[model samples]
Target: MTPDLIILADTIHTMDDPPLAGPEDSQHVQAVAISGGVIAAVGTRQDAGQWQEADTQVVDLGSATLTPGLVDGHIHPVFGLDLTIGADLSSASSLDEVLALLQAEGRHDDGWLRGWGLNPNAFGTVPLHRSVLDRVTGDQPAFIRLFDGHSALANSRALELAGIHGRLEFDQASEVVCDADGVPTGLLLEAAAMELVQRHIPQESFAQRKARLGELLRDFARSGLTGGHIMDHSEESADLFHALEAEGELPLRLRAAPWCMPGSDEESWKELARSIGTGGRRWSIEAIKLFVDGTVDNGTAWLYEPDVRGESTAPFWPRPEEYSAAVRYFASRGIPTATHAIGDAGVDHVLTALESLRHEVPADVLRRTVHRIEHIETVPDDLVARFQGSGVVASMQPTHCTHYSLADHTDNWSTRLGPERADRAWRCRDLRDAGVTLAIGSDWPIAPFEPLPIMADARLRRRSGKPDQHPIAPSQALTARQALEGYTSHAAKAAGLWDISGSITVGKRADFTAFELDPLTTSPDEFAASSVLGTFVDGQIQFMLERHA
Candidate 1:
């Protein structure tokens, strides 16, 4: 009974626990034996005797903490890694700084030039209009996506390209902001802005995109992420993944969910579904993605009340009826729906739609589908009970609290939501108590994709920078063990791969993350700053941090 590989560590955390009234129990194992890319044994050195063989490759990770590889349940990986090449205005503290950065980057002769990460609330004033961007961009089609990715600021050149001078003929949920003189403001909110920007940004070739994606996947391995869920996949992205798999360039496990638009034809969706069959040993395509609303930063998150500034109740999906139809259609066809809902109104609409679908459809079909509400921020207290045993998963990001903490106007979120609703923000513990399965992720480009920051925030209930700025109810904060499980087993279960890749059981895949510090005992600050020592997928070392001895 010789194993192919054996990894010995100082500590190991296997996330196995039912919902507890308190913290989960952590188990320590001295070694793990792997055979045929699967865990053969998890025990002390003596227990490993049964599986030890002469040819077994033993990797002694002297003092590292070993656990199941982290799974990022939601991320825009393709765009995240490309930010370094574009106009990175994420750290621009003021309008002048943003303009200066753009000017320094120089102008492109091509009609389209893009930048991202500009928050109007961070400046404490209304963003400048197209005229301001035009002054600096000088007729180049410039589109700056807000940090939340729900809105964009477009220059006059971009607007002209989109044929929207000032007033835009948009559908129900999209808006074109205009100044008093009927001129297009550079700021385009929600779907309208996205539509305008989409018209100008030229699409990349499949080869180029795949190369960039492969680079990013390797980067993930270096960060100790052995597997992740692609939140938004297009046909081009799927093709890139398959090509990598065929070429043996895919180093990490991939679970992709193709984007499903609100009004997509049923036949078209079914065809797309048929195209994505069951995944192999390293990749999967078992989910569908939908968006119910935009982000709260750009005033597009379909809020129940007006934003604190009294702007407006944010827009929902363009065609609510059509969106619901799409959800029903996906569910009827056996594809689980993972809908993005950031605002209270968006959450309410999705819940109502799901209930309606359940009433109309057969109970067995409804029960089998893995309907998820992504980013359920600002949830109402009364609705907490509805999630229990309802078969809906909550995929939430913990780093948003840190990002939004820097916002200027917390008054609206604080007042409209009040202290009660604010306490429920990313309510992991409450949802767990209510019998809801929880999964964790970093929205990637929205925040750093590192799992340490997420784990720290989840456990400490606040960013490591400030002590007094805890966003949610501290009681709702998850224990370190629960948070880790949310990123691993719970995430795998959400993606319907629990039996194969979540834990270090005998039959599961040998995917593990080696951390420099013991996540369970490390201080929140240290954990947030700790580095990944290495990552292994299917018993193969994909990334090993070079030790500077």
Candidate 2:
């Protein structure tokens, strides 16, 4: 039978092999043929040639590798794009540099200035307070987000606009850092606190957001991403994403989760659930997002003991039982829940809650409502054992450790957790060994959006080229194939789309990520430096780096 398209590559990792190196090594298949948006055959080049006909289009991927389309298990597309609108403080090395960046960006016509990706380590021994930000912004309302997305720094004007003066009540571990005099210092920890200033900041229009999202999707495709499981969904996002899907031919697939905060009323929960109707072939909204605790960098992670700074250690949901009830509330309705649980205490709370629901919900219901925990940053052996066959996914980002922390355990995150807990950083290998499903992601605009670098980091656990670059917890590093699975098969399982996507097998959707070199056998440095030659979705080329360039 004739095929619609044929691709010949040096290697093809079908992800269907029995725990082998790659498909080329296991099955000796060098070519794949597609028809009607599904894989028709996967065999040798000769086999593919035999299926060629008058209309068959053949693509020669010289020395390139073809694998299942990459999937970022967790990302924030709309929010990431929104962050790109202002000056990027990600590269600032010191507090003065951060102020210099804000001064360069200056005030906007709205009398507000915005910046994202501020690394807390830049402050060094200095405390992150409004006094520093006020130096540059003066009267302008300046709001900057830390690289971790768990905290923010707002100038005094922005704080006043948010009406935050002294202490406040919050369901989560959110806090407005106050001075010795009980006055806010312009530092907001966690979503609840950050939202105070975030809500007051000028928001982008729906049309502007749509345009930015379109650009972001194109960027995703170029980076070899064909699917992204978005963490949070805004009302504007729901409208724009559905509109994009309706327009047909999305560059990539999106499985979004509408946020479910801690303070919403029960009726509001139902309203939020009803708001997520259904999506088309390229998108879906079938999950809800929640945060159990904040991050360790800002001393918000719910650790069993206090951080080195002796800061408040509390769960995002003040009442543990209330959060447990909320999880079951949504799970009973057949909706999956993804919770952000970073510290060991936070991970324990989530696992205990899921265990409690084991008896209440039926087998099928529980399986359908597979819960996921994002960024299990620090977990003990006992808590890790709880996820074995528990149907909970460990959605992790390896770059978080590589980019944010150092091997010497002196990074802000490590110093906060202290030597003991910090040594447990991202247990990727342990989770996989315990039979827990692992789904990897970039958490973009926070780290990087590219999958290759993230995959390499997961495998190598250290930066490339610099011999002095130490490996942060090398014992936790994942194998190359295991890291690949984090972005392919396991990522699909994380989003509950394994049947239709994930693997490059016959009768499955023809979504593929093409690299200029065989990523499986390539050196970590080379793979990290490699470019994505092409990204195909449903047998159609959505992005070709050369053509676009």
Best by TM-score: 2
Give the per-residue lDDT of model 1 (tens digit) for 1-549. Answer: 579999988887766444222322234476888888888878876666666778989888878889888888888876554443468887787778888888887765454667777656445554557777887888678887777766677888888788787677655456788888988786877654567667566766778778888887888788778888877765556566678888784678877787776446888788768856655557767788888887666566777876665643654656687778888877887778899987777888888888787777787887667789999877777667777766788899887765564322253244445455465667778887787888998887877778888888888777765577744557778877778888888988887677787876768889999999988888877888888999989899988888776
Ten contiguous residues minimizing lDDT sum, candidate 1: 18-27
Highest lDDT among the candidates is held by which one? 2
lDDT of candidate 2 over 355-431, digit per residue (tens):
88878887788876668999999988888888997889999999899888899987898888888888999999999
Which run of 10 residues does model 2 get worst, by summed lDDT? 17-26
Q: Per-candidate TM vs. native?
A: 0.90, 0.95
Error of 1 at 158 (Å): 2.4
Q: In model 2, which regions exceed 4 Å deviation?
A: 20-27, 246-248, 275-277, 547-549
Clashes of 2: 1
Q: List the residue pairs that clash in candidate 1.
A: 130-186
Candidate 2 lDDT score at position 428:
97
Query: What TM-score, to 2 decimals, does candidate 2 have?
Result: 0.95
